[model samples]
Target: MPKTISFNDNWTFTKTDSPAYSRQTIVQGQPVTLPHTWNDSDGQGGAEAYYRGACWYQKVLTINAEDLSKRIYLEIGAAGNMGEVYINGQLAAESRCGYAMFRAALTPHLKQGDNLLAIKVDNSYNNEVYPLGADFTFYGGLYREVKLLVMDDIHFDVMDNSRDGVYLTQASSGEGVFRLDVRGRLVNEAAASANGRVLVQLKDHEGAVVWEDSQELAVADAAEFELSGSICNPVLWDGIEQPYLYTAEIRAIVQEQIVDTRQIEIGFRTVELTADQGVILNGKPIKINGVCRHQDFGGIGNAITKAHMELDMELIREVGANSIRLAHYQHDDYFYSLCDRYGLLVWAEIPYISFPSTLDPDSRNAFEQLELLIKQAYNHSSIYCWGVQNEITIAVETENTYRIIKELVAEARRLDPSRFVAQANINGVADDSIINTFTDLVGYNLYYGWYYGEIKDLGERLDDFHRTRPDKPVLVSEYGVDTNPNYHSYTPQVQDYTEEYQLLFHHNALETFKARPYVLGGYVWNMFDFGSANRKEGGEVGKNLKGLVTIDRSLKKDAFYLCKAYWSKSPFVHLAGRRFVNRHEQLNDLVVISNLQHIRVYLNGELLTEIKDGQPLNVIKAVRLILGDNHISVEGIDEQGERYTDEIMLRHVLESDSSYIYVKEEKTEHVVNWFERFDLSAPGQIEVKEGYYSIYDTIEQLYRNEAAKAVFLKYFAHVTDNPFFEVTQGVMSIEKMSQLVFYGIPPELLPVINRELNRIAK
Candidate 1:
């Protein structure tokens, strides 16, 4: 049985005082666990402001040094930016890279007696080492898995450590001749040269012999080795569709005794990736319908759980997407494993975000991380591409970084030929010809009307990209913005600035894709609102609300289901609400549409019409101009030819006139509070609310006018200038909510007041 150990326990700690290392103070704060980090608490500004310098952590562990008599090694999952290990005050090993795993042998240091382990966690910024350009806070301390393993005299020796993580290389198909290359580094911290014979033992289930080997290596010098073998009765591993895993154990032995051991799951399947074909698995064309994800959620920050990741994947799968891009940096191992089991395609990347202009060092880091990513994740075949960077060229707005990225792309392809190499850019505008020379595929993070205004201009942007670089495959990597669902009131008129407008925006986007052959795929700007301490919605209080789902993952706006409808082929007939047949009579009846492909609209099981072209966008029909709870079904088509359908309840209202207007008054109490108290949050919410409300046909105009007016209210209150939406906001001329202070109204009714502004401005 595989031995299980825990790195979570009691430890003594002290803070280093001076560079001389003479003054040190011991303090008790809290307990820590392996596979952990001081990510959240440190650098919190107030009480937990992050401190620099040396902090030591010590722990007493019970070891079977006598009975086991085998080689005992101390394994550290990860440390902060950098760390040094000391067993019984004797320096054991030193390491860097806050993200990878490292281990050190402790048997030689053991004097057949009780020992103490101390680790110095150094998180000070170092411009020379990796993870330097990363934007987020570099929390100090040990923040990964830690363990102590006692193995047989001659166990399996470790071979490689990749950024993707430590794992055996995986190939497609198990029946063919397979080579198992076990790689690792053996560090000998000794005065004299220590010679040890490394014996590689390959064992299978039922204790069957598959392959084995041995090599003479000197421990004083860290040496590398690769073991090869073939399995006759091979077991293949695949994803959910054909789930199967074969286990292989490779052990390093010395003098007929095991010393180190490692296990791997073998999966047989080739990932055929190329520019023209995209990603192909098992000889079939596959599209990576994925999302660029951030390793964060509402409250959890980066310490998200498997449950959290699963929920996001579940949502992605529910929307018929089968791939994901682990944007900007490497994530926890659990996420990649989840992809393997769930059959979601992955594009893992490094943390070379937009930074300083000079990037020669980035090249070296990229090369190192590339090796780490490929070597560690070589076993799992879910990864499709290695995303280089997102809009760094513009974020830094430099030429040198562009050249560095260009060379790195070529290097990535040379390192990992099987997987595709991608770069998330800010649209192929500036470095047009240069981009195609480097990347296998180009992903453009585009925000047409939202950021630059003129949503209609997206076509021209796409046209220019195709005209400039026609050979490269294109993708709309990121789009969408913060949207809120609670606010109500909308009209389905063109340019009306309501939920209808948001619907039109996406509808236009979807239509745009249908016309463009250069576009392969597109993912929204974000999946959900995440936490960024510095971002107050830009002078506002809430976090990133751009997700189709809310920050807490609780609320999913109508935009979520609406976008789902565009991509969903399933049958869906929704009765939004009743329309105005007559105003005074107050008829609670409306029209319903099918959100799926040709689903014959049936009223009481009578065929109303055959929904053909508008299957996705238009799925409903007029039914007594309806209201209240109603039974509906999205007809599901299975092999049996039995159709299925989905139903929903909506309270539709009737409109009396083509043009309607209303104005409400507020008291002086509401005015003083406006200046006396400023909620930067209110301004930020205006855009998100508009983005969500823009689901209606005329939502943008409403947003351009009402939401813009509200934001201006707050900005004009203090700054007198707001760069929030320079281009987009200019489309509408409006003042800030301070007008409310002058008019004397309730601050709570800002939504209503904003809506009235939408009516008056139009």
Candidate 2:
């Protein structure tokens, strides 16, 4: 077995722009612990953008002389954007993409004792690195666990970045029979290659060896070998029903003695998406009840702990999510492992988000990141699809852009043919767009009622897309509205930041999905509100309130229940708008969301209405509001007579009560050019409007072609004054007046935006 130790304590950190290093810098550095970040405070607010530069971490690793004979390797769980590792002042390894795990061999660089291990982690805004511009904050630091693994000479290859020397992919052949394909890469440091023999075994839940296979191959320095076998009776890993897992032990033997061993968890299942059949799992059609998730939590800025990850997974499961779209980028390996153990189907991808101004470095980084993501996550059975890009149309698509996209999809298939390749497009991108045709299954991030059209428009647009792309499978990868728990609205409308509007938005979106079977899945934009750093809308600064739950996971919004009503099978009733206790409207709608058919609503002690066998959306009963506090109770009964009920106390206020009465009426000018905030001066308004027209003219002239300018205008036009959308769109309206006014935008973003604008300007 492999021996490992946590190397996470007693580290020194400092911010440095220079690449040069000195021992004095380390001695005077601030002391800190692992799971720490430099952007903890600065990255959470919109007061000023966080620092976009490099930082250094230094730690001393002491190794005994006797342990020097073992093969030693240093493993970093994660680093942000870019990281480089050094031992005893000598370069050991450097990793470009920071999300995945990387292992560097340290046997050659270590001394007898007291080896100095220095790591330089950079989250600086680099135009070459991916996510140069995305919605989420790119936190800087070595924010995850670091470890040292010691093993014998004959060991499995941990340097592949995937960290697994062994891989397992399983499929059901027939009744009670399964095919388990295994791939193992081995390294023999011993003088003679003839002494190496690899052993692979699969063990059941009871720890009994059910299948065993051994092979002897010609091994020089390193060799990759494959084994094909069959299991007579396999316990299938079905979603939520039976998340069964089998343990696999692969041992490398030299001269009949076990030298190194690796253990991996394996799940047997198959996933397929058909244009007409939707998602098929293990030969059964299953609708994907899914949600998109961001890595950061309330206090943790991407420095998530195991407990944090566990809680997030628990919450996702509680909300009845059968699948997860690991949005924008690859997550921690441990979280992917949890998905394997929990049987949540996953859509894993790289940070190839938004649009790229130039295809050179951004697409180059995308290719490298995709390689690392697939290599590290290849063995996970939970990943059914590999998402290639997200909303790249935010930037103008060019011939070079098309070339990069086609390359990514082809490379993903070449690397792992077992998983389907997918990508998410921005709204307004036509179904016949060339980019949509690159992926096996196409996904679009659409917000109909909230962004531009009515709720009913969701179904119509989906139907239109399906009719056009009848041979291709499609999914609504993201759809949501920002909702603040503190905000309440009687006449809710788009962008009201009210809980009522959130519920209605989801109710309509879910209804659209229910109407079309061709749309395989729909994932909510977010499961938990996340830190956007530069966001100022939604009644909260530096946060995206589109999540079903709060950033702290403290409160579940009313929309969460609306989703549960349709997605969950657990019979339960929840009173919507419990947080909005003070109501202004006399004709109040008392709504109850439940999976159960029969629900009875009671006002005070008297029965108001018996909603027998109501629709899955909601059970609604209108009531006249009293002047003071009123008690309301609702009970739902399942077929088995098991009852789930909820009650709440609501206070009715007169229309004259200014604090309780809330109404929203949208202005056409403000709605069309939504980027301008209410704080703009009369002169500033004229300047902004002029800048907007100038920006559009520049885009048209620079793109030259109608197609490119059309795509560019879709993202930049009507952008909110907040640069959050600007970063995502990658288009800077370089009207000088506009840039000077929007000073809150990080200084680093200006260079990127201006460079693209200047390209067109010239």
Candidate 3:
């Protein structure tokens, strides 16, 4: 059998790029371990000042005299953006796609005693890369595992696109039997042909063989073989309930001697997406309780350990999530395995996100990355759909852009016909646009409550989409608001970044999704806060606080319990405003969230109210509190008669607490009420003049007219010069545009600019 060794230790890393390397040079560099990134701190510290250039990692390897005759290969789990591997200062292998595994044969370059292995990794701005522009920071390094494999002269092919060489396709063979077709490649590096027998065995979870087969084949340089096996009354890999898994062992035998062996964990299941019934798994309808996740940690950036991934999985499961959308890019392989074991449906994708790149007309990088993503993760049973792109039309939607997206969808289908292809469209894309019809399923990243419209608009908009495209299956891919735990409000509003508002938004969203059977369930925008270097909202810079859990994984916001109350079957009760203790209002609303049906509330040891057959959320409105400190307690009983309780102390203060509010730095004047500064003396003075331009006109219209263009530049030059302007030029009117990117413009000057544009003739 082949031997695999860890190559993650005793590595030296440096931010400097040097053409020469020696023992002294490697010793002089900072000593580091594998799964390391240089941008751990700066990447999360606001301002787009993180390092994004080439860095070098060097390691020394020693080979014994006896192992010189065997074949040696280096396997790299992943590298950010791009990487080049060098052995003894000689280029051996290179990979451009950052999220997939690749391997290089080091047999030819190896000598007896000692060898130097160096890797140059770069995460710089590359227009040719799939993620040309996105919201998350691209932390650069060898952010995954590295290993070395030693095998005999005849073994399974390690150069097959960095896959496991063995591919298994499974299907239901009627009468409770599952059939599996196994295909694999074998290579003989010796100077002659070799005859071998390939043995395949299927083992159950208890390590008992359920199926076995063997095939005899002749190989010259390389050859392929196919074999089939069947299992009777197999246990299905159900989602979350069972999550049963089987193991497959493949061995290459030459003349009655095992040369190489490979083992893989496999599962059998079936998934179907229907327009009317939503997702069906194992002949039963299942609503996808999903959450999207980013790979970075609080301070670790992208160079995270397997323990971190395990903790994330535990947290996600705790929140009663059955599915996870691995957003934008591919994640570590261990995460996929965890999903398989935990039975979490996965939506995996390449990072063909945000703006489409015209620099590469064919979208070659996009296609290549998709190929890598699909081929590398083909065997994992947790992944049900392949996401092609996310918000690609946000910047400019042209014929070329549409063509590239269509091709990507086609490529994804061609690569994995068994899985569904999906895309997440930006909010403004019309329902009838061709982009919505390019995939098997379509998801809209709508933020009605936070970004543009009222919270009630979410269900109405989804209803409109169902009426327009009844044949298409739809999901709400992303929807969230940034929340700061410190900010609290008795009467929450949009963009307040308060825990109360976050709870209100998700409560409404969850109810909306549950009410509509035609619409598939929604995935929360994020499970945890993440680093977005360009974001400066929610009283934090370089971070998007739209997560149920804090970025550091130290705190679970009140909204987390709201989701847990709805989805989890476990009996528990949670007080909604645990952090918002001090309040000025004499009469306040006390909220309780629990999975149990029977709930009771008490104030200062006095029974306040009781609810029987209650829903997940129960609100006791206008409860009068004492002048000083007051005690609130909620108790619930499940069907099993088990008791669950939660308690909190609220101080009824005489004066309002300023610390509960998010105080914005005075920006000359408060821009939020810019429209309030409009002259109301003349009732309808701001009305659009006929055949003339005004704030009501689209940005594209105003930019086309010379007179209106000059007026627009006079007062709003900063808006036109912003990168966001390109994303909204043709799609949004000036009045609506200002609502999104309203900064720097003085509140008092808005009416003057509108009046100036109102004077220009169309």
Candidate 4:
């Protein structure tokens, strides 16, 4: 049996000025733990930004005398961007990809006693490693677990970025029997020929060996072996219903002695995405209720533990989601294992995102990184598809771009012929684009309601795409609106940080998805808010507030219950606006989300109303609130007589109190054909004055600034006469225009905007 030890403790760390190797550098570092990032303080959000450069980590390995005969290797679960490892002043290995796992053989450098293990990690922006310019922050460090593997002279090949050098591919042949093909490589380090037998066993959760096979091989320094067999009456690894896993044990035998052994926990299942039937798992059709997730937590960037990953999965599963889209990059290996165990279907993709960089270096790095991802995560049954690229069409595609993408898809299929290939295209990709015709599965990251177009356009856009590519499976990969719990509007509009808008947006999107059979599924933009240092929009600075749950994972936005009511089988009722407590409106709509059939609501101990004709996910009714505090209660009963109840207290303040009062109605202008006209101008130059954005910046910041609005309105009034006001409104952000109106736009400024637009037209 092979043994492994934790190499996470007793490490010293220090920031370095350069990526060069030196013995004195390790001596000058400070003590730290295995999972440490230099960006813990400044990476999240600040004007200065975090340092993205080289860092050093060193540790002493005191080997036991008896263990020296064993082959030793250092396995890094993950390192940021690039890493160079050295043992006793000698370079062992170098890895460039930040998200994938890598390993180095330390057996040759290991002495009988103490050995020096040093690593230089550089997360500096590079042209080779992916995500050259992404939205989320990339924190640098040796941010994941490190392990030391000790094995016999003859062992399984663990040198490459593989799932321990052993891979099992299974397909449901017929009559519930699965044909399992197991293959693995063996290394005879002594360079001696030893006639060896590779023994493979399939054990159940009860530890009973259900199938066994052996392949005899004439072993050289390195050799390969494979075994084929059928498992009779095997328990299927069903999604969420029953995530049964089987253990595959591979052992190498020499002269009746077990030289080396490795065991892998695996699930046996078949996944298919069809145009007519949607996602089929194990011969049964199922809908994918999913969400996209980033790997960072609130304060602790990506240097998280298995416990943190488990907690995230648990939260996802509790939301009634049976699937997850691990967005933009390969996630932690342990998270994939949890997905297998918990029965969540996953769409695993690489960060070959945004667009192609330098074809020679960047494309090469992308292909290698993607290969590493597939190899290391091949055996996990949770992954049903491998994503090639995400939103790559956002930039202009060149001939090299098409060539590189084609190569990526080909490489992914060549490496793992069993999985489906998919890509998330930007919304701008037309129906006739060649990019859409390449993948087995394709999803569009379209924010129709929030970004530019009306909410009603989503259904038609998806229908048009399906009509164009009737053969390919389509998914609405990402769609959602941002919301700050503090902002609430009775009449919500786009870009308004209101919980109501998010709720309505999801309601509309889900209805559209439910109506379309050809659409496979949709993954909501985010499961939780994440840190983005440069972001300052939607009442949040340095954060993407589109998550169903807040950043801290403590508060679930109102939209969370809406999804739960739609996806979860568990019967429950939740009152919305639990966070938005103080209200100034005299009449408010009390919303209730439940998985039950009907809901009875009470306000201030009085039976307010009982709603039977409600949407599948939401129940809303207008309620009149008295002065001071009002207590609200709800009770719901499913058809099976399962009763669920919840309560919340809300305060009603008079509008005359005059401190952040609520508005029932506001003057709003819906800008039609805004982007169509805006795209005509190449972002026309407007001088940026000190401490301000361009002239158009009024759309983002001046909404609530009285003094600033006065300055801009006066400035616009002087530009031109009746500055084609209708054209100006149509050529800018409708949400921003609506904000300008709601907060107070001067009537004279409309003509000024019109005149300016007319001058630009001339």
Candidate with maximal lDDT:
3
Evaluate model 3: give its TM-score: 0.90
Clashes of 2: 4
Sort by lDDT, top down from the best: 3, 4, 2, 1
Clashing pairs in 2: 162-376, 675-719, 675-720, 675-721
lDDT digits (tens) for residues 604-650 of candidate 1: 34455555565446534234424433333334343446575655444
Clashes of 3: 0
lDDT of 3 at 60: 80
Against the true structure, candidate 3 has what lDDT? 0.84
lDDT of 2 by residue, 613-664 (tens): 6576554546887888889998899889988899998888765344433344
Q: Would you estimate the TM-scores of all the predictions?
A: 0.67, 0.88, 0.90, 0.86
Q: Say which candidate scores most in TM-score.
A: 3
What do the candidate models score in CA lDDT, each in turn?
A: 0.54, 0.78, 0.84, 0.78
Model 4 stretches with alpha carbons more than 4 Å out: 18-21, 25-28, 46-48, 359-362, 656-762
List residue ranges in candidate 3 displaced over 4 A: 21-28, 46-48, 668-762
Of candidates 3 and 1, the better by TM-score: 3
RMSD, one per candidate, in order? 12.3, 6.5, 4.9, 8.7
In angstroms, how far off is 608's CA in candidate 4? 1.7
**True-vs-predicted CA distance for residue 547, candidate 1, Å:** 2.9
**Clash list (residue pairs), candidate 3:** none
